[model samples]
Target: MKSACATKYEQIEEPDMANIVDAVLEHEADDRPAIVGETRTTSYRDLVDLARRLTGGLRQRFRNDEDVCLVVSHPGLEESLALTLAGWSLGHRVAVLPPYLKSRELEYALEQCSPVVTVSDQTPDSAGSVAFRTLLDAPASDLGSSASEAWLETFTSGTTGHSKCVDRRVSRLSDDIEQLASAMGLSADDKVTAMTTALSTTSVLPALLAGSTVVTIPLQTARQFWKAISDTSITVISGTPYAYEFAGRKKPEPGQLKNVRMALTTSARLRPDTARRFMEDTGVSIRNIMCSSESGHIAYNSSTDEELLAASVGKTLPGVTVEVRDDAGKVLPVGQSGRICIKSPYTATGYRNDPDSSAAVFQGDWVVSTDVGYLDAQGFLYLTGRDDHKIHFGAAKLDPQELEDILLSHPAVDDVLVVGEAHVRLGQIPVAQVVTSRETEAAELLAYCREQISATKVPQRIEFVDKITKDFKGQPVRPKYVRFD
Candidate 1:
């Protein structure tokens, strides 16, 4: 199941579509380190050469037009980036296995992607996975195509309760780079570090494609993440709502990250209080970016309008069109929440081998991945929750993210996941699975929730523990409450 080779740019009418990697390589003003790690600093030239070597290595085991599973566990960030781009250089689709993927999940992904070769740290027990050293044996050549012709296959959580592989071309990825770069004004001059799960489109690829240096800490030791930023004079930091909350409360020593200027939060709800607190403590501004892996960024807060600053996900980036539509697919009026549909070259082609799932979301030129939000009169987007995540409490409906955001605002709460539990009297009730800091007590937290949101939105049960479970990519998985199955 290999993807096709390069197609001419004219074949696709994608706006802002161009070879971003070529642009970065040719136009970058700094020859100094574009990627820095604990032991080494990688310059633009080093990245290019390393990618060339890796491409040559991959060519030995697989043809120019094959897909490969990159089971990267390199200690250095520069090495990881080199391997990824090298696969693209050779026209191979790179499917990254999560750093902490269990044996069974890893096995399933390998079978699905059907990589001809596996580029891994240590050869897995699998008979045919290729070794990293093997890829190094071949010689580098000027690969024929630009990055726009290459692609990566990211696995998304499916409606069938399993993971589905989503095919995304480099052109699609460049669309994201454009938005983040335009909205945040990211430049080569900025040194960014993201403390999110690495096997994500936002955390790794977009930062690299933007030509900004990004630092990644493995998911296994996420607690030690601040050290990565503290050591480097990171200019930009991106993470989930949980990450921002944790960092804001902890307020890591200013000396460790004195140079940081921006903190961007995505993939979860953003709290105005949390944003203000983080900025005050760290001397950095918090920016909210609204997007999904299925659909690229539709809007981002421009940091101007206070109300938009308080609730909305900002404005649409350049060359991106966002529409709020009814189930009938009619465009809705401003300030009315509906299905969010986005048209961008950055959105995915479709979920691979899952036409039904693809058809559920892909509508003509736009793809709607169940985000229920609306644009205000000023065009700022306010996201409620995914349509799939909506739950009924008594006769009232609630979005889990709304409850989750409120729970996270508590000073003693470190992390929280709000899930709907089936009830005999009510259809479903919200339950909070909380990971707390030192001071938060379950009963006190319940009182706080009652004070903040409506009683219907309050958690019917508060389960306090040391940790909240997350997927291999570090996205929070709903903690199931089905006691009897």
Candidate 2:
């Protein structure tokens, strides 16, 4: 899908922090709806008050430029937003930790970030951190701060071992807010609910910073999301591909999302079929955005149809430049696929404490990393696969996304994953792990692939599975075909 209109180029401007908070505050008076929960409706004014109190509390415990780790807190949007804004306003860095992290993972993140303050409802018993708080019932402080400091330290989403921090300059955040506000046509009257966790760079600040009243559903269950959208009168919805797939497969009640004018999916590859089903089920079609924490949102599929939106993640957002490159770092032709690099105002300065890794991924002004794709003649970006997972089979290389797209088109297949694995003979082959309708067989699926794609591009083998799993951020993880003989 093409962008709505080419954004006019303009010099980057830094937003006034006090003005941003005040704009959101002013919007609350005329635009916000009463957020309904188990107890009752919470006015926007009430939410602002809570944020002020919570920010005060967080400020008191963690001084300016200190690091804080936040765990998933339930059923409280005001408290969470307050803590996040407070942390940012006070020039403290915040790290969002997933709730399902095992003790080992938690320990690793804590040790890596070395946060002076840990703001979570789930404080581990053995934690000997500098300062810890439950974040509720804490007293507010009057600490002074400057806007030039770091606001948050977002860990890399794809990393599995010790987390890597991307400490972003707080001043760059407004660039994203402006992009979202323009791309999505956001207004203060829009009540936004996102399936994304607060820890993500895109989800938390952009909605609130765009002057929209933000509502959140605890991500434990999809049903909670349904409830929050209806109860909060959410007009805008944000989620990852997996979350949108769940909504499609589960066929959630339609009444809950009647008021939603737009639904957005980003972070991972979105299947075209899933987009089709989502639009058919809900009146709202999916808005797929291609983005990274390093460079906020680079592009968005603004078309309301499922196929175009799904075909490509879409054209570049305002103030961003995208290019495809080969191993030699030379630019590739429009149709040729290679490493996808982005240049944006919001791009990270460098990865924190990992200059070697940083230098490997970034050039003079662009973030050059694992993403692999190409832009079309029409300026649409099609993400084929991750550079790290590129599959070399005999004479030709295959992008997993290319194969997965073909597999997902099959009626019998519900979800599919393509991954590269070592093969003694071939060196590496594309293995497909598929979740399918009960009647579908591996042989039949393979036959279907033969008709759809070239034999070299077809999967070496297909495995029927009961479920396709996703990571916390809702991207497809391991393809279900784990070979253990």
Candidate 3:
């Protein structure tokens, strides 16, 4: 049986695929810097030429259009963009591995994707991986072909479980680039700090496709990130909540971040307190954008309304529909929280080579998310928590996020995670693991919680920890088991 979802991939046109590189070449501001790094800057003309040369290199090595090219490199660089462009230009499937993955994780990704060619700065222990320096000298040649069927595969953050390989059509991605450019109000004169990698479709591709200059900075401490933004005169910035929280630790001097017009955050839930502190420190509101590896830029809160920014993920973007559904897959009414599902042209068709997993999420034109959220009367979405992260209590199921958010509001708390622990009386009880900034007693926190939340929602135990585990994307790692001291 042919799935209706499968038909979405059959509508690609060659001209649509060609738009990737053409967007770079036909940009009106060709002389302006397209890629600026710590030491060197590449003009638009130079970047297009680099991608052309690399595309020729890719074509010489892999003959089959089915060949997948895996890219593993440090974030915030022109090389990553050039390599990705090269792969797309040759009509080959491309997958980008996170830079921070250990050798074992890299090996797992390699075993999963089995790319015939890999372009990286440092060689992975696996075979078929080539250093990026070797590709730079490859002879330049003009080539024209569209990998319309060859989609780009990106893995989920893997915070809750194993990462799923998501396949997005190149044609739809091109459409998203233009739509995003118009929605974000990006222009050629705008300079964005590419804090995320080329793998991040929302952050890197839209800015480049809009002909905006992107400044790439190496992953650095919070202080270094601020310095880079100030030095580069970065007009826009985007990253995870942790990145913004770390930057909020030290307030920028007056006018230090004057050049930065907009700050965007995604990949994890942005705490309201973090958002408020960031604005107070930098004098800029952090725009909380809702997106996933499968669905690109579903919603964004562009208004300066602090209350709205703190509570909702903002209104849905044009051409996208976000709705909440009950357990029966029936759409719920506004204000009724349930599974958050999205219907959009930009949503990925399915996971590559994983039918069981793909069928679990993709339904017709909708991607039914594992996340639990509700929509307001005004069409704003508010996320509650993940369905998988629920705790089974005596007669009730509790959302750990509800408790964690309350704990995080405390002045002494730096970070917190709530998980279910076995209880003889109740089926399970919630336990809180905390990373604190100052001296704080578990009793004190418990007492504070008693004053704020319901008795059933309060944590039975609170353990102080030095750090909380998180994935490469800065999302909290759900603990598999409760630790006993």
Candidate 4:
């Protein structure tokens, strides 16, 4: 049986709820590239047709508007995109969970949300979970109800704590899409790359809606990531700071990334060295996007101003507001550092099934962020670090990024994490775990820090390590794996 959405497979102008279906149908007749995978390219016509075919399978099992479809994949670009298109087309709440979630963690998510159906590459150890191929070949039926408004539930990175499930309206997701598409100056000719699952939301979805071709590859390592990009005519790349730094570390041959014109990094602070190295090698400056899973795209360093590029995350996106507020919730003036609160039309409403946590962060219109930063006179945001990321020495608080920046400036320091460990007398002291390029000593680095920053913020203990632990996104896993007895 052909689903109602499939009936409009070739012609859906103004679709219901304005989700990915509309994007798919917008170029249903055009065969131009939609997704550029490692081995294959899926055109808009092909992607939409596949999505429409899958809609029939989805329509058979669940009641539209009432049931939820949980998509669990290693997050292959096409499979998740197809399932998401089908789910959103049918008005089901589609929650896309992270691929890295452990089995028990996935079970916890399943219990919390209780989706009526789960789609994944492998049939998860759950009752209603189905494999991608199974759903693709399942017989179509007309048991589905009429489509209604659909919402998407995506997760926060939870870098500092447990990941919260953010239930966001489709229209709001579209809001950021349009704004970001415009901000990036994306055109039909541009080819963007989705480096990781985290990028599918921020990069993949937006690129499709803007009608830009999206490139996908398995980012196993920095070398693998480079090999994938070397041949593709990828113009736009928006990924984690880890991706850029990791790629820049090997230092590609001159003009290796010549085709790339624009580079964007997520909320993770782009190391100045990494940015400078990428620019020198590729001739494209990496712009830092100050954003979170909770607030969507808040501010982007979209300017060419040297000071702005060096110090801030640029200015707020259109229709977005940023304020620096003190601990007591009073708004701080320009140049004063405090909590960075974001008020946006497209931010997630609240955490699903977690009211207390939602109430703490999602205060009415503005979502209070743990990030601490200040705005310049021109409204550019300069970040110090997260509130929890701060290391306390006696009563004095230490900004890890600030100290890391000072350490990184020294030629000897390669990559470093400034974590807090307890001292016998002092409650918490800053400890610098350094990864060096050349031979360096704790005393030499100590002298460098003493010259750059305040004596109190300098690392009390500097440990020479081969490597520091990093998250999947290439960000340092904080607290430094230091075991304190």
For model 3, residues 244-344, the per-residue Cα lDDT tens digits are: 76677677766678898888877756677777788778878888788887887789887668888877788888878887999998889989978889888
Q: Is candidate 3 or candidate 4 better by TM-score?
A: 3
TM-score of 4: 0.73
- TM accuracy, model 3: 0.75
Q: Is candidate 2 or candidate 3 better by TM-score?
A: 3
C-alpha lDDT of residue 427 in model 4: 42
Q: How far off is residue 68 in model 2, in Å?
A: 7.1
Residue-level lDDT for 379 in candidate 3:
85
Off by over 4 Å in 4: 1-19, 98-100, 124-127, 138-148, 158-161, 197-199, 220-224, 389-485
Model 3 CA deviation exceeding 4 Å by range: 1-4, 8-18, 72-76, 122-127, 130-137, 143-146, 158-161, 196-198, 218-221, 389-485
Per-candidate Cα lDDT values, in order, are 0.64, 0.62, 0.72, 0.70
TM-score of each predicted structure versus truth: 0.72, 0.69, 0.75, 0.73
* Predicted structure 1, TM vs. truth: 0.72
For candidate 2, lDDT tens digit of each residue in 1-485? 00111021114454444333444455455435434344454666665665567666665555554445443333344445555655655666656554444453455556555543455555542344322344445765432332456455666633212335665655666556656666788766777665534544455456565666656555455676677678777888877665675555455585888788888876666666677777777767887788766777789878654577757888898778998999898999999988888877766665666666666655666778677778988888887766555564542446677678778988888898888776533446888989887687788888877776556567988987887788999888854322211
Which candidate number would show the highest TM-score if scored against the true structure? 3
lDDT per residue for candidate 1 within 1-485, as digits (tens), equals 21221132225576654355564455334566666655567777777777777777766666654445554545445666677777666666776654444453456566555553555667653546766766676887454334545777766541111456667776667667665676687776777765533544554555555677766543233335666677676778877665665555466664766777777777666666766676666666677888765676767777754455657778888768899899899999998878888877667667666667676766666777567777878777877655666555543446677667777888888898888886543546778888887866688989987776555457889988788888999988864322211
lDDT of 2: 0.62
| Worst 10-residue lDDT window, candidate 4 | 1-10
Candidate 1, pairs of clashing residues: 57-135, 230-256, 300-314, 301-314
